[model samples]
Target: MDFKNSTENNEKVDANYNVVPLREAMCKTERRLRRKIDIFVVPTVMLMYLMCFIDRANIGNARLAGFEKDLKLKGYDYNTVLSIFYVGYILFEIPATMCCKIMGPGWFLPLATVGFGACSIATAFVKTRAQVCAVRFLLGIFEAGLMPGCAYYLSRWYRRAEYSFRLGIFFSTVPLSGAFGGLIASGILKLPHLGSLKGWQMIFAIEGIITVAIGLLAFVTMTDRPETARWLTEEQKELAINRVKSERLAQAVLLDRIDATKLKRGFTNPITLATSFIFFLGNVTVLGISFFLPTIIRTIYPSRTTIDQQLLTVPPYIVGALLLLLISGLSWRFDHRQAFIILTGPTVFAGYAIFLATINANIRYAAVFLSASTAFALGVMSNAQVAANVTSDSARNIALGTNAIFGYCGALLATWTYLPWDSPKYMLGNGINLACAATWTIVGIGAAAWMVYDNKKRDERQAAGMEEIVGLSQLEIQDLEFRHPAWRWKL
Candidate 1:
């Protein structure tokens, strides 16, 4: 019944009567299935996230197109509006992501997309800072589920080792949205004002409409799971599902009905807490860069035209997008997440240090490239790392949701880090981000070291017969989740 010890090229029957195959025999089939899954599944989620990020981040673009001027936002009012979004975001993320499972991702993700898109559309008509805050808060409530939901959704479809790269592929949309959003905003800003909408209003209205269309398309394009995927054969579905099972703790089923005990294990897991905190630190940089990059660009090129400033924001995001793909691809190829995560420390430290240490316009501008490279890559690595550490579907959902809650709390901090008073050369903001990156390095190193230690201890316990797992029933073994004697943390 232990599929791990199954004979080569043979399918072993589990206690529940599922026939799981030895991974070695399925190489060619897996590659083909992976490609098919990539085509059918990845693109739908990627497009969804691309619009999700665009709709979320376009506020930065809107700011440059005179969003603040039009709304009469004064002093800390802009920061207040930005910070309020995360209040709804932080409070509802876990509940919404939990709902992502109960409602099915195919239905839930698109519904969330529509809700946030409508909120974004509503922003176009806001007349006061209070209106902006209200709309953004609603936007936050809708968007709260999206990133974590997409993460948990993708985790369902891929094996542990394959997750980081595929997640990277999905998250590549973050920087792409930044790039394309800028280009789109630049073009939109060039047009004459419509009936009552200014360039900024046009930006919100147009981008929101596109997001709504994509959300509607997702209803048809997304399949809830492999079993229901019409594009896949029964054979392929079984293979897809079993291959993932082969790598889980005690060969656990991919999806189990959610329950209170499993949910508690998810929220209390040490790996979840550690990775979520690391993600929190990472978000301070990522969200700061996202919401304020346009403002940074404006500061750097004050004499340039507004259109030129928008175009200038494009290059750093392009660089960030490329570096994210390259790094995450290597993480997948090498089958290591923590090492790559630890390796990002120096790059991020140097990036923020340059921003603080320099007054030279050209040099500070170049630092944006270094900063971009690692900002969003952490989101992929941390999510994948947490997903790998957990053992069940419900637990995975909660772990990812918990990760988002902490990460967005950091986002709340980022909103206020760059106040209007911190204008050209926002030394305090750069210093705060620099401190976050340094602290993140320490935490990343600590987490990796703990994983190494715990894995070794587990090995020692197993060797001494103190933690035997042989001949245990599937339910008993699976209830252990990451605590299983045979389960090792993916370092």
Candidate 2:
């Protein structure tokens, strides 16, 4: 341990701040800072996410506008383009997160956004299916960093109890993008053939341009952390820093501490891996629905034109977005995460059940509303849990990034699950989603139970003065604060 550095860090706090009760000061500063943080930081990042999701998934809308036919995509090439976004997406999530953490989101996020925006624009110009696939791959690499980066960024600003609502607010933007993208594409697709560009080309070019503009704004507006926030006073900064250091899930005990060893600890930890698989199961429903719902909706309304179908797609996602916000509010108010996640599984199960059992398109359409509402809400609760349970930034990058990879794996499954052969009546696809929901239900139950037991055990250990990691533990594991007996999972 660096005794000198530790003392200096501690004294810096004491020397600058007045002697006041921490709880009183925190309570006072928290209210004010919360408002400021919510206003200044939350909305900015939420906009970035909105732009991110819309651009990433607008290809669904683009497909309707003739992305597939224009390039003469043969065989499974369309699916290849759809699914290939994650090839780069899954590969770079962790590394990009690490970069975002190291470089600060202010610089890194905007840069990544510009990269994806450029890719999105280039996707409009592709001459062949190979070019489409290549640009989509590049788009994935840039967009991969944003989701996990958003999670880690918020972990720095909010405490455990406040996390879900903020996550819900930010993540709600994902489904909202569906509604927004559909509405935008409905109009954008009608642009008179510009030079040689088609409707789908216009969708990519217009949305991509908007995304790039926002990325430029994000560079100027975003703050690195509360302590480093130029908008705050020294006292406010101390209050924020102290509150985090005193927190159970503080990313780093000190602002400057990274502990590269936290990386190895996260990889080796059983609980971290378990949580990720839980994320994998939870993600299957949402990602599956997001990527495929437009196509699924097209089949549901066979009578409608592609533009009409695009217009029709907006309402379900709007409902899902609104419902996600309500659910996230409840989860945050109750301060229990798993119960909400467990409840969502059944909702998804019901939706999938209806699809598999019946031929009624109306009934199946209703099921889409039910499933998307629940699936999108799962991310609101699940993402907060990922942030709350992990110990440090390094560990968070590894664990959350690993979880994202699992998510894309589920997304990969989603692309396959609803094949054209099974379209309109996609019994096999619905059945697989049913199994996914059921597995997530089981995992949610087990994880909730384990958290209860683990929290109890930690309580017992702390009472018995046995908080420390036992003998011969590595330097990395020793630095992991989540291993302490005082740590409690937000069950």
Model 2, residue 46: distance off in Å is 0.9
TM-scores for every predicted model: 0.94, 0.90
Show the lowest summed lDDT stretch of 10 residues, model 1: 1-10
TM-score of the candidate numbered 1?
A: 0.94
Off by over 4 Å in 1: 1-25, 463-474
Residue by residue across 1-491, what tens digits does model 1's lDDT show? 32334433244444564445335455667789999999999998898899888888899998887888888888988889889999999989988998999999999999999898898899899988888889999999999989999999998788877889999999999989999999999988888976778789999998999889999999999988999999999888887787777777654577898867677778888888988998898899988988999999889889988889989999998988888898889988988898877776677788889999888889999999888877778889888888888888888889899999999999999998998888989998998888888888899899889999998888878765434766767776677777666778888
RMSD of each: 3.7, 4.6
lDDT of each: 0.86, 0.77
Instruction: Return the clash pairs for model 2, or none.
Output: none
lDDT of 2 by residue, 275-329 (tens): 5676677666777776777788888887889889898788889988998988888
